[model samples]
Target: MNVEVIIVLVALVGMLAALIMDKMRPGMILFSVVVLFLCTGILSPKEMLEGFSNKGMITVAMLFLVSEGIRQSGALTQVIKKLLPQEKTSVFKAQIRMLPSIAFISAFLNNTPVVVIFAPIIKRWASSVKLPATYFLIPLSYVTILGGICTLIGTSTNLVVHSMIQEAGLKGFSMFELGKVGVFIAIAGIIYLFLFSSKLLPSDRPETSGNEEEEQNSTLHLVEAVIGPRFPGINKRVGDFNFKRHYGAEIKELRRSGHTYTDLGNIRFREGDTLVVLTDDSFIRTWGESSVFLMLANGKDYEPAGKKKRWFALILLLIMIIGATIGELPAIQRLLPEGIKLDMFFFVSITTVIMAWTKIFPPQKYTKYISWDILITIACAFAISKAMENSGVADLLASYIIGLSHSHGPYVLLAAMFIITNIFTELITNNAAAALSFPLALSISQQLGVSPMPFFVVICMAASASFSTPIGYQTNLIVQGIGNYKFTDFVRIGLPLNIITFLISVFVIPQIWSF
Candidate 1:
């Protein structure tokens, strides 16, 4: 290989190491690598920054506003109250009643906010019925994840992958195109959870040092926080970091991967480790905006601030989905120029503006609602994919995989791609994992002399199927802290579902899309 290719491969290795090591945020890590490639003249400035203006990137941004508007309007919360019967006490009965609806709603909304709105409500309901919140919280997160895979806007990862497809000069996914394989995966996942989650999920909540009376008070915040790259306590043992003094928060528990640590004195802070913490209302003001925590679940649901505009927000969202889906029809495509056409980007942009104009969600706070870290990670992903292509690293890796799997057939290759992407997703952000895998999948398709569509669909499924680990998906992390779950809890419940999705996606994807 040439020196340029060698440099690119070396840089990729370093980037992967940093990401897996959890030394920095995925966005920053990716952006830094793209910058390195730019400075080395491997990628031009325009190529480096192209992701910023990408249709998928921008669509995700707009959807955030749309989701925010719906969330702020209180429509979903209203629907939840009406659909979930307060009298239900049995775990199986409750899940059967709730999970399908959760999945359906999550299919339309963002996964994080869906969990955000539903988690506390479900927890309160469980407490009233004398049921462990643990049983429902993990399932809630799982269902949302399953639901997210069913639609393009369901998860940001799908949109990121779709954007990469268009950039690669392929026909991008429609609004419901992913639903083909995704719906099947969702059904299999939900069934697995329904059949097995009760035994797998933890039934007891984590105990705190506080008295029963103190625990009963809602004012005593029980929250979960993930250490971010900028967290000051990185590499420092819990006893050394004096969290109570520094942030006025007590670390009740620390969980990394599948292991739970109660002996905080010896535990060092690491990125992606979930910490169940106890603090008060002031914690939101102090650390809400800090990058030190990738996520914080305060275990309190805010009342809908724009309750009056609920119907308006819901209507706008529905219109956006329907309008975008219809805009992709052949008749619609015929009317527009080859270069210009109405798609999700157009509908989402219009909906976001209407929401802002009507004050469904304050336009002033629009930027705050959008997760810049995720957007940056996605934007940098495009540059990283370009660097891989320009360096011939993608082709090189493709050749090796093709040689090894030539006899095993493309089905084996599909399974391998799914496993790699799934593993990467568990270790890093889903969108980042999808971005890194897209170029390789395309190259593998080229090497096999088959359609790349199956590879792309597998990448989408694998990246989103992060059931085995809390850190694999953001929604899982959120529920991990809120539910006071141990690392084993996820593995117990999520592994089977992970396998179920793996099997269904691998067998069914090629059949539908053809390789």
Candidate 2:
């Protein structure tokens, strides 16, 4: 490799290390790498800043607002209440009733908010029915992931890949084109979870007597909160910070990884740590939307919009989805004005404005609803992918992969690509994984003289097949904290689902899309 390639490779390694070590926010870590590439002369100024204006990245930001409007309307909350069994039911029966609907709903919205809104409600319902919450939480995360693969706008990773395709002067994904392969994967994966998840997941009943539980439930509010970067006590011992005095709550227990500690006197607080706190019902109302905590469970403080408002929000979302799907048709494309197409960016922007004007979510406070960290991470991911291609690193890696796998045919090459992307996603952010693997996929397809569609589809599936670890996906981390699960718990159950997805992608993608 020449100097540019060597430098890119070294920076790539350093980026991976920083992301794994949790040294900084993922957005900052990725942005730093892009700046490094800019200073090294591998990328022009426009190339370095191009990601900031990417249509796909901007679509993700708009979708966040759309999701928030729906969330504020309490529509998702209403759906969960109706899905849970009113009477006692077996875990299998509950999964039958709940998982499929959740998957379908997730296909249309952001997965993290779906999990955030559904997890606590499901956990509370499970506890009331005497079922273990652990059995359900992991599956909730996995099913949302499965659903996200079914459409172009279902997940940010798919949009990121689509953006790269369009930028390369090729046709991008239709709204539902990925559903050809993704639907099969979702059905098969959900079936696998139904058969084995309850048995594989641990059952840890809370330690409390009937009367004590009854009294605690009636009198005190038990809430679970994850620490955020804005938390004042992030690096201080609990005793030094005086949690009860500042937040008007007592930390009854602290959970990190799989371990639980009751004596939190000297424990230094960290982001993502789950704390089981004993406080009054007013606690959630006081800090529900505050930046001090990443997420607060048992959120009973939110007020639902009026019935008319809820219906309006749902109808608006449906219009956006249907509009985008129709806009991709050839006839519809021809009817549009020159250089103007009615795509997701167009529809989502329109929907967001309508919602904002109608006050579906607060109009002036709309900025708080967006996750700027995730947006930055995605934008930087695009620049990093461009750097890989500009520096010759993607081509070099593609050549080595082809040398080893070409003799076995393109099927083997697809499998190799899936494995590499999956590994990166399991260790780092999925957007970054898709970004890094994308250039290599393009290079490999060009060298083999085959359509790049299958390669592109596999990257979407594999980058999102992050069932084996909580670290890989935000939804998994949210569920892990709320359920108090061990790292090994995910391996026991998610590893099998990962294999199932891998097998399906390698064997099925080519059949549908062709090399």
Candidate 3:
């Protein structure tokens, strides 16, 4: 390898270590590493910044607003209420009643908000019915993830991969193209959950299920608080911050990057650190809207979407999906010029503006809903991937893989791609994992002298099937906090599902998108 290739390889390793170690945010780490590569003359500024303006990245931003409108409109709430069993009996029966609807809803909406809205409600419902909240919360997150993989817009990761495909000068994914394999994966995941979750998942809540009376009487609550720009404790050590005096909350654990820290004394406060606090309900009422904190989990009530507005939001969502899917048909696509054809980006942009104009979600507060860190990570990923290509790192790696797996056929290469992407997703964000893997996947296809379709599909499945750990996906993190689960809890429940997805995806993707 050349000096530049070696440097890029070393930088890649360090980036992974930092992300897994939780020393800094993934975006920050990735951006910093790419900058170093740029400084060494490996990547041009244009290539580095291309991802920032990518249709995929912008689509994710627009979808955040769209999801917010649906969330604030209370449309999903009505649907969920109808779907949940009125009287829950056993964990298995409740799951049978609840998980499918959750998956269906999540397939359309963003998974994070779906979990955010459902976790507490399911907890409360499980409590009222005298069943364990733990049984339902993790499955709720998993099903949403499964559902997300079913459509092009189901998760930001799919969109990012599609964007990469387009950037490579290939025809991008149709709206439901991924659903060919994704729907099957979702069905398989649901089956796995129904068969094994009751036995493997925790049967009791760490605390009393979301009972108001019990919550009111309890001396402490495990609440999550996001540090806002206005937080005064920034740059101060946790021990010196006097959190109890300023916010009336005591920190029990701190989650940054993907690592959880309990050693508050030595850690410095930073914006975006999710502090798991031990506080009472009163703390929520008192500081719920304070500028010092961006968001307080389980604190504020979501205003139900007004009657007329709720229907409007749901209709707008359907229009985006249906219009985009129909627009991609050969007949309709032929009508429009290739340069400006109707696509998911077009539909999503129009839907967002209409929703904003109608005030489905407050337009002024739209930026808060976007996950800026994820966007930054994705944008930087494009640069890093470009660096890998330019510096010969991707080619070098592809040569080794081809040498080792040539005897086993392209299936081995596809399996390797899936395994690497899934491991990266577990360590970092799904979008970032997809970004990093795409160039290498393309290189492998070129090396093997076959179609790249199966490789592309593998990246989508592997990057999004992050079921082995809470840090693998954001939805997992949200559910972990709400369910009060330990690390092993995920391993016990998720490993089998991961294996099932692996088998299904590896076996099915090649058949449909043949090499």
Return the top candidate by TM-score: 2
Model 1: lDDT equals 0.84
Report the number of the highest-lDDT candidate. 2
lDDT (tens digit, per residue) of candidate 3 on 1-515: 68998899999999989988766778899999988987888988888788788888999889988998898899877777776787647777778878888888888889977877777777777778888888888899899999999889889888888988888889888888999999999999999999988799877644422345437767776777766546787888998879999877778777664357787798998765668787788877776544566546764445576799988888899999999999889898788875986888899999999988988877887777787878888888878888888999888888888888856889999999999899899887787788779988999999889999899998999999989898878777667765667778899999898888899999999889989
- What's the TM-score of each model vs. the native? 0.90, 0.95, 0.89
Could you give me the TM-score of model 2 versus the true structure? 0.95
Per-candidate RMSD, Å = 3.1, 2.2, 3.9
By descending TM-score, how would the candidates be arranged?
A: 2, 1, 3
Worst 10 residues of 3 by lDDT: 205-214
Steric clash pairs (candidate 2) = none
Instruction: Single out the weakest 10-residue window by summed lDDT for candidate 2.
Output: 205-214
Cα lDDT of model 3 overall? Answer: 0.83
lDDT of 2 by residue, 376-491 (tens): 99999889989999999999999999999747878899999999999999999899899889999999998889998899999999999999988899888888888888889988
| lDDT by residue (tens digit), candidate 1, 1-515 | 99878888898889888988777778899999999999888899999989999989998888888887888898988877876678846888888889999999998888877877787787777888888888888999999999999998999999999999989899989889999988888888888888888888777665443445346876776676766656788888888888999888888778765456778898888766778777888886667645667566665665665555887788888898899898899998898887876788988989988899988887886887787888999999999999989888889988888787866878998998999999899888898788779989999988789999999999999999999888777778777766767788888788888899999999999889998
RMSD score of candidate 1 (Å): 3.1
